[model samples]
Target: MAYVPVKGGEAAILNALDLVAEERRGDPADPELTLAQIRTQQARAVDRVMAEGSLYDPDLAALALKQAQGDATEAAFLLRAYRTTLEQFARARPLETDRMAIRRRISACYKDLPGGQVLGPSVDYSHRMLDFDLAGEGAPTAPRAEAPVAAQMPRVPDLVGNEGFMEPSEPPAGDPAPGDLTRDPLAFPAPRDIRLQNLARADEGFLLGLAYSTQRGFGSNHPYAGEIRMGEVPVEVVPEELGFAIEIGEVTLTESQMITSVKGASGENPKFTRGYGLAFGHCERKAMSMALVDRALRADEFAEEPRYPAQDAEFVLYHSDNVESSGFVQHLKLPHYVDFQAELRMLREMRAARRATEQEAAE
Candidate 1:
């Protein structure tokens, strides 16, 4: 069980790293992929990197994607780590979805809403068929109708709020500052704001699994998708010297509004409770899953006891981080000779003891 170091491990590790770099360089003559192409062409991918990273620089996200070899979670971690190095200039004002330049907006609760259903870029209704022509010289496409402006489109939540059909999602009482999960460590019995911030940047796969668990009778609530919208929302920052808020930039965002039934309280009519999700880029699936988990974590607020893993805040939030989970899982690949030797010694001792007992019994 004594320690025995591997000879030439340092040299082998350095050589292995070099081999990995060389392997990443596929055909030498192939055209290099530019950052612009990754930002525009691999837009959805870049969006995912930005969302999960909690940083919105497209160029950095594109670079992270290239460095990570298109692994979304790895790319996000790269960007997330880089963000800690940057200086905090100013915090942006809370986003206003009402002013969003909507590209895609749909409501499941109503067929006819203020702006009608705008089914933007979605393949939900498309047939699953592979095209042979795409492999050959690509074919040209015909021109289509000009896209409508997003400013004119009305939100489904706004319309419902007018008639008081759904409860209003007012800002947290007293306009309190929101928690920054990246800067501060997560603790047990987290606030709703912190829970949401953590979920917003949590791994998409982890959130998806937890959300699916909620639907399959683990912590099931009769849920309905009130609305899901994808569009560009302007970012505003108020500089202390400037004395007023100004638009700094615009970023694409996907917002989900989920409604679920809760038991009526104290002679009041049963009202639809809300679960919300917002993320960078066209991330409908992540957004929806986030909304479901957000609602599930609010069991105590709704006067419902936690009955499942999905509903347990401590369990879900701690294990849902991709970076932490990935690092822990991948770390097993490292040498564990010391630990293995101890196990081997224990096994040998057990076998020798068993043989001595057998010989005594036979005699």
Candidate 2:
């Protein structure tokens, strides 16, 4: 339903908007969903909204999700639209993931690595069956405790790098401040920084499909999951007067690193390249997908052919944004009266001319 208010359409628009609010409220007999409950119970949805919205406020994300009626992309769009009005104050300093409080860490390549594995809060090894017992308000199971994981878990990439087969994470010069896509318009052949920002906020399903394409042998770069870790990391910012950085708060993050090999020209060693992904909460799928696509987009650096859609930078970057995609599609529902009338007039004239020509031929 078109809700845009015209000069004489105020009354109709108000009624339409009220109807929407009523629909959103659902049955009056049923209990209304509270923002607190949504944020706590539907935590994954909140995380996704925060990640795609590029905002870290869980409460706002939860409200957006509620407002959007559980539609994740719509909620994300709402969050992003609201973000435009906020003024920038300070950019947090880069987070130190190594210092993350150990919660979940796993590796696909090696069963044992430095600091060992801590499969914290995962369903990977669990059965995929529904438990009807969970349908009702049941007794909550108290969380079991084990010996705390090591304070500092060295990243899996570092362990593999000691063998001298792994490629450096940074460029030859070094990793400069990543380009901000929010501040600048997206350009073709974007830097890793810009590419990463886009992928992080991209629709999870899009990235997952692209990542799967590489695994299916659509692209030649064979990959192995180097590491996946999720935990809380502190956000720090340095004031202009004070040279020291202070912690503002902590945000949960899931980081993924995938290793793929780059063939050397002539008679040279094939060094292992890295695909890195990071998501705003404990979002493993998005991070893993982002890492895979990140590697595939680096086809230029590896001097590999971009035979598949996954490897094409322009293809991935342009279509990955759900916010932009949804906006373009939803805009078609708005009034297109003038354009439609012009098309209708042209079609009528063409039909009339065709009928006249047929009569002349018969005569």
Clashing pairs in 1: none
Candidate 2 segments whose C-alpha is farther than 4 A from its true place: 1-8, 172-175, 361-363
lDDT measured at residue 311 in model 1 versus the true structure, 0 to 100: 94
Tens digits of per-residue lDDT for model 2, 207-272: 999999998988787888899999999999998889889999999999999988755656767778
- For residue 57, model 2's alpha carbon misses the true position, in angstroms, by 1.1
TM-score of each: 0.91, 0.93
lDDT minimum window of 10 residues, candidate 1: 1-10
- Number of clashes in model 1? 0
The residue ranges of model 1 lying beyond 4 angstroms of the native Cα positions read 1-7, 137-145, 150-154, 354-363
Report how far off residue 214 is in candidate 1 (Å).
1.8
Q: What is the lDDT of residue 96 in candidate 1?
A: 88
